[model samples]
Target: MDIVLGLQWGDEGKGKFIDLISENYDITARFNGGANAGHSIERNGKRITLKMIPSGIFMKEVQNVIGTGTVLDPVSFKKEILNLQLFDHTIQPEKNIIISKKAHLVMPTHKLLDIFMEENPEYTTIGTTKNGIAQAYSNKILRQNLRVGDIWSPDFQSRAQHILYRDYKMLEDGGMIVLPALEEISKEFFDAVDFLKKFTCTETEIYLNNALSKGKRILAEGSQATMLDIDHGTYPYVTSSSTTAAGACSGLGISPKKMGEIYGIAKAYCTRVGNGAFPTELLDEFGDDLRMKGNEFGSNTGRPRRIGWLDLPALKYAVMINGVTQLVLTKADVLNGVKSVAVCTHYELEDGSLETVSGTLSENIRPVLKWMNGWSADFVNMKSGSELPEELKEFLSFLEAALEIPVTYLSTGPGREQILKMK
Candidate 1:
């Protein structure tokens, strides 16, 4: 199976690229994350933001799988499936989509707890989407969570109630007030659980292995990005789960040896949502211009993203961790009007020593930028690398030499067809 994931923080235009490339694969499976991750795709002049569903859902020939390592919110899943069904009448969720039975369900209390934690003054907020991802994963690790398969069992409702009350007690003990009534929340939760039962739920690990044995091509779609991985990313500022290529194995139940190409997706520039140590962040008017031109807003939260120049050191760190074989540079057209483009190649410490991305980054570090002349060509409508301007070609060449990775794909705009396959 091949993997497609973000190399930067998040919002690296992964959805459009996945949708553009899914035609070659028989299956496109989401490996990690939940409703907190949004992939927006535009096709036929209409656009839709996908949360839990894989971007390949628009393609009738490709089967989309929600794998085991993900946490599912029944309400959000139901809403997404219904929305896609209404958007395209040809999409039959029961026929083309598969939900892993081992996937954990996100409870209402999880979201409540998420809000409580973020609102609490005693702790530093990670700027979560308040989707209950961290709380849901906490329940999973504690073995007090509900799995997708549990909805079919006789004690499903009882088990869910037990966990809900447990979480409520924990929250109350933690000084949380203004809790929603149990009856009101349970009604909606159970209703969404009922709605979730109509879909195909099975052991996806076995099914995926069987399909692999049959030589079916599988595309593992990663949510979030490598820089947000729980263990590998910047601590406390990272997501709840792994978002690297190795995550596809445990997330989708595929063997590491079965992995093929790793497509690392990033923007021509960089943009991060929420808070973190951003060494190359642009604070000037050009930063605002990049945001306006690229439309750099969070699809899930609708918040403005923190814009910056491309950090080559961080990109190289992501490539190393994910074992990225090829790169896909996106949003190059966003840089069309610039006089020069800058990329950060290294970080200079307070003592004036240069360092690569060896560990977690601090806010005090300074960036060493390498600037190149910008291009003015309208490459959004261009389809071939031969049509690319000499200036843009020079920048890409420098990137290829620095990372030792081939630029296989380039996306100039948000439209699905705006991408060009360079290789």
Candidate 2:
């Protein structure tokens, strides 16, 4: 009944928060996105980076479901579930997870399309993860994609072959000579398709509603963040899915009336990956320092993230769009040991006029900042908000008041036990 999602671009430590609070829910489901999402979670001193799998997989009691709105890559998903044992969580796929029958599969040719797109800089590039996400989603929109349930159909092989042929032809149109060998790629693709055929698949909309009638607690997890939403975000620089709360209804097929609190996860600072108009970007030594301290690297691609001061206007916009009920601050202690910190209070427009952020931002706008004192305390021995440094508390209080939301959860470290709740 509860929802957890990111408010920024991505990598707001949402997976960490989901894993930390997943015990409260009986069912945890991922609504949108695919392998492009990299949720890095630390458990028992080991880091586990999940691509297609839900973050709640670490909890033995939780039933994780990948909802129909996802564009799944079956082979990578199978490997992820099979490799969980190496991380000390031996997940029984049939019991621990289920895939929605309506979910579309990421074909091998989708990767080829993605490769073709990313390789061609002549077209506008969103700096995609190149995990075939856009290509897969495009096929779904065009009704040319294959669903997970199609694997069980009698004519699946023919259907897939036809789709592959169309994709190959599309690649040729895109000016590629050496086409992908159908026999070679389909070998692994068909085997994985068989695995998916045997995997548990269901009509999750009915399944979720039925469980809700029985008083089950459901937690819907979102991929990317609000700012990455295709419709509501920075135009060509955004992801190819609905990452906002609206995504929960579309992706999971759950009604908004059944929803509980929406928890928006954000870092103390802000970050973005790839190219975009970042109004508050710190392009100096401070930016580099923050990146080094937070280890701001893309979880999926290992590409360095663009770090910036926390933009209140952007966060406020996200909260407004998502109808976020509460806020969870992650990496609060990353600001520790710093001498000063800056927050974006307003944006200066091209006319030398200051305005609260609105509309699509451009590189011409500049952020007006408010500087604050930083805390040097490590917070390792601290167990509660009362033990937090006074400076840190004041800074958080300022943010809460400005954003008009309570900061309930604070993540001090990467480990599971390093988090504390305000309540």
Candidate 3:
């Protein structure tokens, strides 16, 4: 069974949940995103940040694959592998991990383009990680992209040179100033190409399908949240890929029939990393407290996140798109000290019309919240359903009542064993 999530924002504690459930699955695959993703997992009392690789790689018998839809950042990926090796020599990635040959390469030129685009003060900035995701995908769409398979080709150097020269010429034609020597860019490109050769696999799609055919369970992991989906999310400020469940099929080349058990991960409150429309965002002490308590920061960019009250309308919209069958709420422990909590039940438009929270409505409207009693007891050490505070239970019941989705898993802390299965 495949569990999919991202009910609220991107930092939905998916890594810990995926790791916990990974023991039941044979294969775990990350279908999208690049270094822009920061999936944090706590295992054996240690916190780990997973970027390119699936968070389930820590599982003993599970195999992890980076699907074709991902953009490979060789530098960041290599560092992560080395960091993991420091903890366990037995975790030889070459034996269990595979990278798709069809994945787009995040070249230095891509980074350059990302910076260039963000430098334009007149254009509304999307607050990207500047990791080059947009430019790399742009190259792919423009048909000038270099894939993992192309790295080992005999003509790889010549092709890279030609492409680099063309890109530089295009930049010059656009009246944009260029930096760094052409030769230097070419050298760095070849070096990155060589470094990525060891991780490339040509038949990721075929292998994933074969595993499914053999009745092996697979997990389709998404990086960002539904609100960041390029097509469905807030426009002009969203990510470059499809972060919804439909993306799982396109990203991993799998049939929709093969997917099962959609699980949406969200937080007790809401938070967003970049610039976009946020209806329930708190700009005062309440927001500051949530940020400090939750340690709300972008795992990928290290930027402080914008915190806010829970937005049920947005959560319902996300659940509808991903067909979330179960909900997992994380960082509930962070709300322990608050006396009261507010959840955005609906939106009030500029024209004073009430509407459900959505990309369009959220972008231009304000939120109307429903207040609830907050739980003050510590839940970090609680392992069973009976140990939960009554107020916490009431909060969960409120969420279920509002969204009409069952809350099955609740995470109180950042440890692997910190989750309480409620259903």
Candidate with the greatest lDDT versus the true structure: 1
Q: Tell me the tens digit of each residue's lDDT in model 2 across 1-423.
A: 889989988999988899988998999999999999999989778898898888888889999999988989987886776677677746676677888999888988888888788789787877888888898899899987889888888999999989888888888887887454777778888887777766679998889889999999999999999888989888889998899898988899989888889999999999999988888888899889889889999998999999988988889889989889899998878888888898998888889998765547788988999999999786787788998888899999998988888999899987888888986
For each candidate in turn, the TM-score is 0.98, 0.97, 0.95
User: Per-residue error at 171 for model 1, in Å?
Assistant: 3.3
Candidate 1 per-residue C-alpha lDDT over 1-423 given as tens digits, one digit per residue, 9 for 90 to 100: 999999989999999999988999999999899999999989679888999999999888899999999999998988888888777787787788899999999999999999998999987888999999999998899987889999999999898999888888888889888457878888889999999888899999999999999999999999999889999887788899989998999899899999999999999988888878878899999899889989999999999999999999899999988889999999888998689999999999889999866447888899999999999887757879989999999999999998899999988778879888899
Q: Which residues of candidate 3, in runs, are more than 4 Å off?
A: 169-185
Q: Which of 1 and 3 is ahead in lDDT? A: 1
Better of 2 and 3 by lDDT: 2
Q: Pick the winner on TM-score between candidates 2 and 3.
A: 2
Best of the candidates, TM-score: 1
Write out the backbone clash pairs for model 1: none
Candidate no. 2 TM-score? 0.97
Report, for every candidate in turn, its global Cα lDDT versus the true structure. Answer: 0.90, 0.87, 0.83
Per-residue CA lDDT of candidate 3, range 1-423, in tens? 475668766898888899899888898989888988888887677777888889888886889989898898765676778888886678878778888889888876777678777877755688999988988888888998888877778997788778778878877776678888778877766765666666548678998998888989999899888988888887778888889888888889998887788999999989998888888899998789789878998887789999989887788899888888899999888888788888898898889988764656345778898888888766666779778888889999988987788999999887788889998
The TM-score, computed over Cα atoms with residue i paired to residue i, of candidate 1 is 0.98
